[model samples]
Target chain A: MITVNNLTKKYSGTTVLNIDSLEIPKGQSFGLVGNNGAGKTTFFSLLLDLIRPTTGAIENNQIKVSESEAWKPYTAAFIDESFLIGYLTPEEYFYFIGELRGQNKADVDSFLAPFEDFFNGEILGGKKYLRDLSKGNQKKAGIVASFIGNPEVIILDEPFANLDPTTQIRLKRLIKELADGNDVTILISSHDLMHVTEVCERVVVLDKGEMVKDIQTSTETLQELETYFTR
Target chain B: MLKQFISLQWKSFFRSASLSSNLFFKILTIFFALYLIAMFTLLGGGIYFILEEKVQKDPLLIINQFLIFYLFIDLVFKYMMQKMPVVNIKPLLYLPFSKSKIVHFSLWKTILSFFNFIHYFFFIPFAVVLIIEGYPPGHVIGWTMGALALIYCNNFINVFLNDVDAVFYSFLGALVILFGLHYYQIFDVTVYTAPIFDALFNQPYLVIIPILLMISMYILAFRYFKNILYLDGGLQQKQQEAKTESFDWLNRFGGISVFLKNDLKLIKRNKRSRTAVIMSLVFIFYGMLFFTGAVEAYEGPVWRIFAGLFVTGGFLFTFGQYVPSWDSSYYQLMMSQNIMYRDYLNAKWWLIVIATILTTLVASFYAYFGLEVYLAILVAAIYNVGVNSHMVLWGGAYVKTPIDLTSNKKAFGDKQAFNVKTLLLTIPKLLLPMALYAVGHYTIGPMLGYALVTLAGLLGFAFKEKVFDIIEKVYKTEKYKTIAAYKQKN
Candidate 1:
């Protein structure tokens, strides 16, 4: 569903990302694991067309991401707090995103019905603006907003980092359900090995902006990943 | 330790990210500050001559009588415009430094504030003139020292009162009552103003009263601030519950209306935007100042056109030019969504239109001045809604600066790029109505001039969609550059 050809990103005079070629087929739950400065965000930014690549291109459904606005209708991403409008309340934010995606307010309200436990009763109807929310709660709101549009392609960067253990478990289940027997392409980057192994069917390891290992999930996939990192 | 703190502050000013990111803006700000200082200094030096020529009285006695009024005005300005001295108190709090030392440092910092020295600009020259006029140097120095002391007294009092709830309104109320009583001759404030300062100049010992008052006020302000400096006490009191409001009627405009609703909330909740709205409202009275016999005697369209456009389009000029940058905090989110850029631009356009109409209606009260004033304002309002609205939106396309919504500072500062091109665009918008009115008045008739101005406005309104489309195209072309600019935290 997504193709990257000779994708490279340079800042100042230094190249930060240089992927020769890569592809994620339709309906795949792909995982990206990397250390600090691994160019994970740069890769996602390129795919979202938030930043232009220095060389080559990213294509979504055979349409060049930079050349057209077609991918934006189906793709939803929650990479950071920048993706959330800080002034609006969570409910107002959802309704706005819903309206943008051609969904009515009532439709959004109904879509949010299942995530009440996921939200922990702290987000909606809380008289505070999104800016005033705690960082973890802000992350929750952004993640929930990404899901409201029923997007075909989902991208989340470090979604598990700020969430508490209970919410993290709930999020893993949510991801599993979305990926199960569905043509929903999910791209997630996480530092936590256990969660990535549990949720993602295939994992790609990146070191210094280059893909090092592309491994299918097996019983020993977690052990192999752990050994590689420690070395 | 205090010297160390001062050096740290100097470093912080020069090394701030805002300075590094926009060096041009920083230099421009310094030049502006220097210009203001020079102007005030010149005003100070010329005050003695101005009083000698204009009032034709003992300039010293005249200045003494006006001294109380000056202090009152100075206090009001300080309360409104002065920012509290800020230091990185957080790092110092955990260190071995005593809390009293820190509080004293802060208080000492206020003594050197620019507001305090502004008074010296007027008083220093006045003092020198008094000495030259054969008054005892000792007495003149005493009165000048007394005046400076009172200025510091007001500065400290302002710091004490600003934290108290309802103080601004109370201070304004007190001023109004004092003015009203004096105006109607119910109370003669000058009766006291003249004698008290006359005694201070004659009896140098009377200066002790102001010095004592200054010390007491400083003590009071220091205790108040020190008490609140503790971490637990530093927490703001729980704010009043925010009422959830819905403008359900706006739903008729669909997605574009959602943006409008957000913009309304933005103005209501954010300090920077709220100040802009209040400033626009305050300017509604600007017509009263201009629509006088002076303007009537001048006899041209120049002043009338200025007063008219300002009265009608003040809010649009102040607030609308910021446009998309007002949403810069969440602009990336908006760009990535399935939203149309046209809807965003239209929302801003509608806001400017509504503001112009409202300001024009308020300024319509200037009809009390003359029928000509009323007619001119109506013509200007139509022109603003029709033509200036689009020009302001076009201006928005170039504003790359992002405003911090929560800053308490009244001035948004030189962060906004005010280039020659912007000035050129603004000059024509302001002048075109006058030109059209003049041509029509000279050739046809006065009434036809008003009609001609209105016709031009109507024509511009008729072609608004085409103008909006062109603005949208410009916005689309500059989208990436704008997004990148907004992403910079500085």
Candidate 2:
């Protein structure tokens, strides 16, 4: 479960994020959609306590995000490649993330096994560092590592951006399976309306840092998003 | 557990080794060249001993002094390459590892560096010569091992001291006290030189001092290692107090504020980038070690100009060359943004320019230990603003193998130097500046002629937009070449 109340953030006198009273029940998948500079990343940063909100608070699973240590064990996020230490090999990075969550190298390598075909051996290969990988592969590595511990909550930013279309479909399916099977709360921000529609139970739309819409995907069709963007 | 840590270290080491492997032959060639030079020095010293009735006053003290000064500069230079710091520290923190083990591993890593090989080449040969010429084996062994241990111990101490919160001022205060003592003729060896060198040359017991000092330094290094581990967290992240007016200087050149803000934000967001700036100042103490010789060498007009040039241009040339590429993987965010490339270039240029001007002024005063180097400083500043600016700016644009600012290891030559184009680019930038100096010296009387040429360069830099336009055209046309060049391992 997650609750955000009056979550506002600003940069240089410009309001990059302004939200008012949004809630998501446990085990639900929520998607964030908007044009560039929509404050999606800012909102994620605030919830993660990576950055402080100007005037707001977020509660994840009944624990205040800014003040609680409970948030650490319950949440994992990959907001960007900045979150990944590029000097590390993919396996080393995964083991590092896993160990932080009290898992061993066996668990990390096992988790990495499912992606061998998808990663094309590039992710775990010895010849290159994570930095030397293509953007898509690096995202795959970051995303898998973020999900490695199976935290109760996951937040991913622009997960589909560098991914190939086939991988995008696979990721959407994976996100849905993760939310439904593991009973996890997942929040994802993206520009792709179709992927968000297919994967999320509800979508929160932001424009210029303010929440413009919060609607269940079952209530609003994909055509409505096209109209919204064009308008 | 130590074995496991060593295994992890070997993994890290081989990763670097693989990068180095790309230049294995080149490294071997350089090694051989240095080996031959050492052999020559050994043979020359032997012939000198044979010719003279008595030893031509063992050059050991001069060599030791040079080694100390060299290592000090070498370590400071290593720290300036933004990537070297972050790369060095990252892995050790994650293992079921003690910070002490990690620091020990890092200290071991320091010896493995190519620069540290200088001790083996230069110092060992001299020691061997002394031993062959009938110095007691204990004296030779003790002195050689003691000196090498001290060199590495000093490097470890630098890394340890660097982690302390007030290290910058502590080091500065220490230097000020030492220099004050020197000026007051307190620490000067003239009073103690006879006894000290006498003990060093004749008595084997004096070697114990450096050996004990090195052992004590190793213990201190372990304590520093423990301190880093037990500290609350790795690199404390504190909220920056947002300031509105501090970035106003960029408003003069429209949209320059964006890149300025970005650069400032980077300096704030990443502790390592700020370390690059601080690391530049650490050289002040290192410079003081040879202050007298450096000043004495600058007594001539040519060497004076060089001292002024080096004192200022050295910092900029060494540290300023790799600009925003220091951002490494994080660079994509800025590149992806709608920001103009020129504005980004201008912000970095200005940062270097400001650093250069401040350094030139300080170095002038620092160069000759008097105001005498001030005129050379003035001329150097003009050249820096004019001629050197273009060189650095162009060098920055073409620079592909940007080291990760967060990584603390010096970029492996095999990683960054595989491309022949890097050589091509460096040749013109290095040669043109020297050619200009030579022409100025020959055409005009040294001081005024160089000053006038520098003035002309400054005028050219005043029209930097024109220079940038040319650079931009090349950057655009060579985008594919640049990408291809950078695509290699480096």
Candidate 3:
């Protein structure tokens, strides 16, 4: 569904990302694992066409991401708090995103019905603007918003970092359910090995903008990943 | 400890990434500050000469008579414009620093504020002149001290009252009531003003009244702020309720309306944007200065056109120029969304139109001045809705600097990117209507002049779709550059 061809991004002559070639087939749950300064966000930003790649191109569904706006219709991302409108309440934010994606207010309300427990009653109807919400709650709002339009391609950067243990478990289950033969391509970057192993069918390990390992997940994938990290 | 606090403030001022990144703005600001100091110094030097020659009464008495008015104006400005000095007290809270000491330091800093000293620029020379005019030097010193004490009194009162949201309305209400009573000749403040100040000046020892008042007000404000210095004090408790509200009626406009609703909430909730709205409302009365007989009986309708346009479209210049940058906080999300750029531009256009209409309605009361004034305002409002709205939106496309909504600074801090281009673009937007009015008046007649402006507006309204198309194209072309710029923390 997505193709990267000799894609490289640089800032001030220093390469931040230099993926020679990569592809994710349709309906795959792909995991990106990396530590700080691993170019995870830069990669995602390139895919979202937020920043230009110094060389080559990214194609979503055979359409060049930079050359066309076609991919925007089916792609949704929640990379950071910047993705959420700070002034709007969570509900208002959802309704706005839903409206942008051709869903009405009532439709969005219904779509958000299942995430009440995921929200922990701290988000919707909480009277606080998204900015005023705790960081974890703000992350939840952004994640929930990415799901509003039933987007074909979803990208989330460090979704589990700020979430509490309970919400992390819920999010893992939510990701698993959404990825189960739903024809939705999910790209998630996380440092937590256990959750990534549990949710993603395949994991790609990045080190300094270079993809080091492309491993298909199995029962022993978590142990293997842990071993790689310790080394 | 006070030295430590002052050093931290100095570091924060000079080392801020926003300030250091923009050398041009820093230099501009320095020059602006210098210009203000120079103007005040010049005013101080000239005030004594002006007052002595103009006033038939005792110059000191005349100065005292106007002192009350000056104090009133000073109080209003302090309440509106002065930001309370803030430090990151969180680190100090857990440290060995005493709360009273910290509060004292903060309050003491206000004494050295430029606002307090600017008054002396005018008063010092006046007092020196009084001394030279054979007035008792002690009496001159006493009255000057009294005036200075009153200024501090105002400063402390404002510091105490600033946090109470209702104080703004009450202050406005009191001013209106006082002016209304005086205007209707029901109560003459002037009748008492001379006697009261005369007594204070004659018996210079009575300066103790203002001195005492200043001390009490200082104590009151110091105590108030100290009580709220704790982490979970009234400051945190006063976090505005975050109730969710949907403008259901706006949903009829579909996706564009959502953007409008968000913009409305932005203006309502943010301090800077709220101030802009209030300022626009206050400036509706700016037309009163121009609607006088002198301007009306002047050779041309230029002043009328300027006043009308400003009154009606002032909000556009204040708020609209920053359009999408106002959403710079979330410009990335907005750009990534599955919405058309046209809808966003359309939403901004509609907002400007609504504001112009609302301001024009309020300013229609200027009809009390003259029917011609009212007609000029109507034409200008129409012109604003039609032409200037799109012009401001076009200006928005070039505003690459992101406005920090969370910053409590009076103006948006990122000034380097918003330099000459902004002024140059805005100049034509202001002057076009006036130019059209002049041409129509000079060539045809006054009635046709108004009609010509209205026709221009109608033409603009008619071609709005084309304008939106051009704006959308501009936005699309600049999208990547703008997003990258917004990503910078500075």
Q: Against the true structure, whose DockQ is highest?
A: 3
Candidate 2 stretches with Cα past 4 Å from truth are A1-195, A198-231, B1-111, B114-116, B132-134, B176-186, B189-220, B223-246, B265-272, B275-300, B311-315, B357-375, B402-431, B455-459, B473-490
Candidate 3 residue-wise lDDT, B1-490, digit = tens: 8788989889877766546455665576567667767887777677767677877566677677667778888887776655556665667788888989888887887787667877887778777877888889988889889999999998888775666547866877787677657767898676788687788888999999989999999999888888877656634523467878888888788668988888888988876577668767866877766775433444357778877888898788778888888899898898777777887888887888888889988886888877888999998898888888988898788767677775522111221222333444567787777887888888988888889889998999898889888888898888888897788754
C-alpha RMSD values across all candidates? 4.1, 17.1, 4.0
What TM-score goes with each of the models?
0.87, 0.56, 0.88
The sequence of per-residue lDDT tens digits that candidate 2 reaches over residues A1-231 is 899999888777888888888888989899999998888887886777656677879998888876654677768888788666554567656765675566666887787887776676666655555655679999988888778777888989999999988888788878989988978999999999988988999888899988888888874657788789997
> Which stretches of model 1 miss by more than 4 angstroms?
B1-8, B20-24, B60-69, B75-85, B88-92, B95-113, B133-135, B157-165, B173-198, B230-232, B235-240, B292-301, B408-474, B477-481, B484-490
Better of 1 and 3 by DockQ: 3
Docking class of 3: medium
Per model, the share of native interface contacts recovered reads 0.39, 0.04, 0.75
Maximum-lDDT candidate? 3
DockQ of all candidate complexes: 0.54, 0.04, 0.76
The per-residue C-alpha lDDT of model 2 at residue B100 equals 66
User: By descending TM-score, how would the candidates be arranged?
Assistant: 3, 1, 2
* TM-score leader: 3
lDDT of each residue in B1-490, candidate 2, tens digit only = 6677567656665665224533644565466657756775665355435434454555554444334345554454333321222234554467676666666665565556644555566566666777776778887776667667666666566665454436745654665565467577678533444355345546667777877777788778666655644324433322233322234455465556555544664554344555545545543333443346635543444554444454555445544566545545544333222245686677777877777777765654564565544665566567666766667667666565545443322211112211223223334444444456666777776665566647666786888898888767665555433433332333
Tens-digit lDDT track for model 1 on A1-231?
A: 999999999889788898999999988899999898889988998898888889999999898988888898999999998898766788888887887788888899999999999999999888888877889999999998998778989999999998999999999999999999568899999999999999999999988889999999889999999999997
For candidate 1, what is the recovered fraction of reference interface contacts?
A: 0.39
lDDT, candidate 1, B245-323, per-residue tens: 6667888887689888888888887755776676577667666557764445445655676678878887777788778
